[model samples]
Target: MPNVPAERRRVTLQRPGPLLIEGPVEVTSENGTTVSSDRFRVALCTCRRSSIYPWCDTSHRRRAGADDPRRAQPPPT
Candidate 1:
């Protein structure tokens, strides 16, 4: 049998800096567990310290969307 990926997986980019995930999602971690959900749209925290865990708690507002520039920046000299 051939392997098949979920056809419903999709991602949306928001202007205010929120990534919207749609359809079925399979979130996996090193803990050997995977979280699956059918939520239409869900937000994931990029701040890495979200009080809401996987969801964004608007923590980015504290730094005005500049909390982790180094996260996307190249290695320091």
Candidate 2:
């Protein structure tokens, strides 16, 4: 909005977690590719484990076990 100040925003880096940033943010890659978020807050992938890169899906918390969300589907026979 026009009322919003044009200033540097804050980014929070959580230990062993994604970067928490106030959103409506835009991220540009080294190759010039850009990603944008219009959310009020955003969790940026840090561990590079997200299937959706640049966005945190909590994939970094994956553990080798049967209770994992990544194992939602059973392997085909």
Candidate 3:
């Protein structure tokens, strides 16, 4: 077979939200594992808050009076 470049995808950057891409897409992890989505649009989580690992479940959304576990607090008086 002749050498050819891989297909390029259209990705939309959503601040504080998942990285949206036109699917179906195949994502390969650093450990050599892979995951896929067949939806019209795929949401890849950037904040590591998704229970589905590489996929986004909107867990990054801010909730009322919810304290972020990753934030540093001031010293108590």
Candidate 4:
């Protein structure tokens, strides 16, 4: 079979949100752990709050102000 080159991919930066990238992507942590995904598009997390590290889970959409009622509060002492 003839060898074929992969198409060039582009990345889109969404304001106040995750970075959208064309995938088959592999993300590696500082400790050398790697995670990969073959999705047509991937949302890379910018905010550190994601429970699923390196992937956006909409955790960045939460209100940032203390006045916002939707913000998670600490347990009462």
- Candidates' RMSD to native: 8.2, 7.9, 6.0, 7.4
lDDT of 3 by residue, 8-76 (tens): 789999767789999878888889888877788898988788899799899888641265555676899
Q: Which stretches of candidate 1 lie over 4 Å from their true place?
A: 1-5, 14-16, 65-77
Which 10 successive residues of model 1 have the least lDDT summed?
1-10
User: What is the C-alpha lDDT profile of model 2 across 5-52, one tens digit per residue?
Assistant: 766777999856799998888888778888888898999988788888
By lDDT, the better pick of 1 and 2 is: 2
Query: Candidate 3 overall Cα lDDT vs. reference?
Result: 0.79
lDDT of 1: 0.64
Off by over 4 Å in 2: 1-6, 63-77
Model 4, residue 49: C-alpha shift (Å): 1.1
lDDT tens string, model 4, 26-72? 78877998898889899998877788979888788773354457668
Q: Candidate 3 — which pairs collide?
A: none
Residue 47 CA displacement from its true place in model 3, Å:
0.4
Give the clashing pairs for model 1. Answer: none
lDDT of 1 by residue, 1-77 (tens): 12456575578876455567874566664676666556777777665567765676777677755655544765799
TM-score to true structure, per model:
0.55, 0.68, 0.69, 0.69
